[model samples]
Target: MNYFKKLLLILIVLGAKLPLIAQVKLPALVGDNMVLQQNSKVNLWGWASPNEKINIQLGWQTAPVVITANPDGTWKTAVDTPKGNEKAYDITIDASNKIILHNVLIGEVWICSGQSNMYFPVGKEEGTWKTGVVNYEEEIKNANFPNIRIFTVLTKASQKPLDDVTGSWKECSPASVKSFSAVGYFFGRNLYQKLNVPIGLIASSWGGTKAEAWTSEKVLEENTDFLPILENDAKNEKLYQEKLEAYYSDLKKERIANNNDLSKSQLKKPKKEDNKTSYVLYNAMLNPLVNYTMKGVIWYQGESNAEQAYLYRSLFPAMVKNWRNDWNQGDFPFYFVQIAPHKGQNPDIREAQLISSKSIANSGMVVTTDVGDANNIHPIDKQTVGYRLSLLARAKTYNEPNLVFSGPIYNNMKIKKNRAQLFFDYAESGLVKNGDVLKEFEIAGEDKVFYPADAKIEGKTVVVSSEKVKSPVAVRFAWKAIPEPNLFNKEKLPASPFRTDDW
Candidate 1:
């Protein structure tokens, strides 16, 4: 061969190699050492030179599946995930690149979402946060859900939808379970014990994140009822960056002035003009895996939006519908942990959650007013939060018999003379008080000046009467901050926080 001809061939080879190196990229969620969902169809995707071939293999199945990259340099493949133990998987693309995912498990999968309460783990505990009927250590050791794996979605907000998230899946073992959402773990453990199946939990959450952040901007814009909140988001995003910086600066100064450490799970001063709050996280985190199939979702949020109680009545339902539509799974059993008791206010936000829970279709809420801490926003007793969520799964999702799902929910009321007669839907085992008289019942006439009312459990109903109001028009139970509410069913679940009057 002539020298000129050989030199030209080498140049062509080198040019081809450069494109191979620069044109290939993998989605963060599909990187090395990841776990795929089992007993169902799991998604695997990434980017490469347009029109390149991609192949994926799993322990549960034989033979690799081939796919072609799109014009936009994206590729996707769904594997019929198998139920199995911790195993290794190799996914190869175009016979040149390969990703090895280790320690993958297959079983029932769930999504645990919310603010910090659902994000709180057993490791991040503070003594100030306490709860009732929680046995943390026992639940942890007894959590032999080896087949149960968990993948946590990081807190990232975006202006538009994303294709891949920045995290991978991990098994639900002692080592990995410590950082897993405590409530999610307990909920899965309960299901594992009851159903004896593998469980995968996807916890996508952020501390102090409002409900609007997890929802898509398009969905928010579509809902005219939620337009006000979405409008505020546009305004805040425009004015937020600088205000956020200033707010952090003040927060740092306050901590330093008080000789306190801001690193102790504390947030800084509120930004004056942060309008970009609504759709940021939706694009970054949730949009990446909008179609991840799951048996159900366990939500534990609402502290950040507690003040906007009325607004949440619309925002919460819109977000749920948006998610169900995005998943395209026909309302696959939406279950969530009711906002537990948090900081000064006891049951108002809980009531808001109850209102949203009833509003959504094919959905149920787990009441936690009985499991709240007045001083701490992040309650440490996540065991109950998870177990109760799983209980809803037991009766509603898995069709298990003899499991009580919820407390007394106000179905209807009859006002006669000075007293109101209340009837409940799920009054399983009837009504009973554990200790003091039902503490949160209040009565008011047309004036709506609430006065303490006497309450007595009559069969499945709690008759509330007030001497101050001769003709009672309304009644509220467990509706105040740090309210001494005490109405429960014989099954031990707390009665949902409710008010008879619109106000």
Candidate 2:
């Protein structure tokens, strides 16, 4: 070929490749069908060539935001979002190459996170063990809310923090909602129906994971009680390496013994690292999402931590604080579900959750004593759970007055002769037993020995007395692995289990 012809070809190739390298790049979340927090300055970040000038044009506004990339090729800027509306907007980014994000919405965005129950989908699969939520068929068919959107972070674990996650915003439809988080969907649906605004739910969860896996290492290190989590994780990593080495060695020997027939060998490979390892999920899943603005969070977990339920009293609150600090959003609402009645779940976990709800400010808890099943770990009635969470958000976050969002919480106990009078906080209209008589009440004397007590409701308080204990010093109600407490407030919300004594 001629020299002039070869030079032209090289120039053409370089022109095409240059734009590919220098063009702006966005995170998975800052893409099409994304929802930015309404009435707030939402952060938008991306990478580009060093010192490159970028122009961002919001469809709702006329003035374009102009910024320059840093030396490290990272750039972030805040843009104001209007109030929630049905009008669709577009975001245009102009730099080395133009990129347009279409169909953006401004509304309430919530982060839905936790373990398996939070990860449960709305529709059942054919081969999997997931039986789906109650009335799954009808629910899935009616899930056609165009204003509600969901972004599900794929399961990932890392030893170090990540820059971005793997997910995309999808419009809520029968096809899209089936695989999305059921609790997240229902919660968003309720919010959309009540507030009549665009609702965005980001589901970042994994089944059978622990709170330590979702908590940051800095927060865990601050407390001496959480030091064991880091120590145990180091030990587990070492053990995994040792097991992997042995497995490879055994597999090599098996392959040789089978005349080099790889198919005949039955040696199984060792797993790399557990998803339940400390801070792995936070590094991979949650860290990548810190830049995105959200209204609040909804969590459902604690089954795995039941063994060390005592530690969860501190661990759960620390985890919430870590996220709040990282997000830099001042004390945003964080609502969670109390671990329900199950044969394998300890009652201490529920108590720890109840304590956390009181300890943490702007936090709410949904009690599921009435909806729990003794044999099933994952409850089927997610609609009620989601609706109750939405009620808390409506009453507390959205400032809807005169709404009963919580069940009755035990306040203080007073001893009157041979009986103990139990007062509660949310029994404004008085308490009522669902059955003929109230059960699960027990009275303890000075010896700390508790016996079944006869309980009767008077006004907003319940009086308990036991013939076995003449002098009642304390009282405990629904203190068991699986309890069927019939107590409820006039709002039909069940009362959380409580004990006057620490023991």
Candidate 3:
């Protein structure tokens, strides 16, 4: 009996020791078909047993990097990447165990994120609501770019920041591209075609989510304008249980009324889901991607924040600053699409986006005034949106100085004797009205009442005049909530909406 006890004790000790030798793990991004940012030192991190020595070997480089896990079982190392090419690479890591990442590429890795428009897929397989883009069948059939890779973050929301997300790199093909974000796919395709380099797209977008959901909590806390959001969220949390109980009671009453054929109108609305809570998605979707190196980011959200458009001017820039700070990259390129001309969107939100684009360094905004559909919030012309974004990338990020990527933007206005002369910027090759007649221009006098103004292109400046207004103090162009833009640059890019009056 003593001998049996000794054997059992020895087995128990061995079992306890087995778990101490933890198997080395990697983040979801550092896997098969992944693309590392080219010509940069990209961060590669993972977890292992405390004090364990981790060895990393890159197929493209000769020197192997060695690191030690911290007390918390986390380790990080940066590896140098070569310029973008078609060659496939490998990464081998060994610690308590071995992990080999296959088919890695060196190229421009971009993060495509925002709301429903950015989440819309290239084909119909994503869900019942995501009914692919226009000519999606042809687009899918032609999506065979072997050099382009895609990684989509799984839809998940959390109140606290997560270390890693759930995703895997996929090579671009008909089968794999079917469920990919249409805007992301088209953007990558255009980049590959223009630069002739491999493109890796990381898509982390949720439909109908607000911009604050993707912004860091710290950012929202620092800004005074966003304090209301936090305060309201806290109050809402406190009331949530009571609200839920009331919802159930109301639901029960509605059920009884329905059974009696009386009415269902008394049913109460349930509290908003946790996913819509501020900073939830950032904690889940964006926090895990903070360290991943990327060339730039493309955003396509703002409709959800239209009600708070006035606040977005401050909040949006703060969010961009927060992202740049977390990435430790100095003002990396950030291009965004202006909210299209849908009935639900207001001019305030569009103006806020324009303000962000103008204020944020190394950033650009694509205007979708002409392409937006009034009936459908998710416009089917995603191709034009992607194409315009690529133009900005090609011009700004890729060092193509000769490319005219932007349409005419209002530079300054001169009011002289009842006529307003609007000087424009980016009127490359001169400005030309889209239709036979110029429209959507309004001029206001000192009384602040606006009247239809006759606008005509005179060189790079547009002259606006009204028969009634004797002294035009302000001028506006395409300032309505939904406008069919009629002005375009020689490149056919539509001019962004503008108003001279702050009120």
Provide the clashing-pair count of each candidate structure: 14, 0, 0
Model 1 lDDT vs. the true structure?
Answer: 0.74
Give candidate 2's error at residue 290 in angstroms.
1.0
Ranking of all predicted structures according to TM-score, beginning with the best and ending with the worst: 2, 3, 1
True-vs-predicted CA distance for residue 76, candidate 2, Å:
0.7
Q: For model 2, what is the C-alpha lDDT against the true structure? A: 0.93
Better of 2 and 3 by TM-score: 2
Choose the strongest candidate by lDDT: 2
TM-score of 1: 0.84
How many clashes (backbone atoms < 3 Å, residues ≥3 apart in a chain or on different chains) does model 3 have? 0
- Candidate 3 lands at a TM-score of 0.94
Q: Could you give the C-alpha RMSD of every candidate to the true structure, in order shown?
A: 5.9, 2.4, 3.1
Cand. 2 TM to true fold: 0.95
**How big is the positional error of residue 264 in model 3, measured in Å on the Cα after superposition?**
15
Tens digits of lDDT, candidate 2, 386-483: 99999999999999889999889999989989989999999998899999999999999989999999999999999999889999998998999999
Kindly list the per-residue Cα lDDT of model 3 for residues 1-503, writing each as its tens digit. Answer: 69999999999999988856778999998899998999999999989999899999999989899999998898888888888899998899988799999999899999999998998899886355456889999999999998999999998999899999999999999999988889999999999998988999999999899888888888888778899989878898879978888888877777786885635375557757776788999999999998899999999999999999989998888888888999888999999999999887789999999889999999999999998889899888889999999999999999886898888888899988979999878995888887888989999999999998999999888999999999899998888788876998888988889998897
Native-to-model Cα distance after best TM-score fit, residue 345 in candidate 3, in Å: 1.3
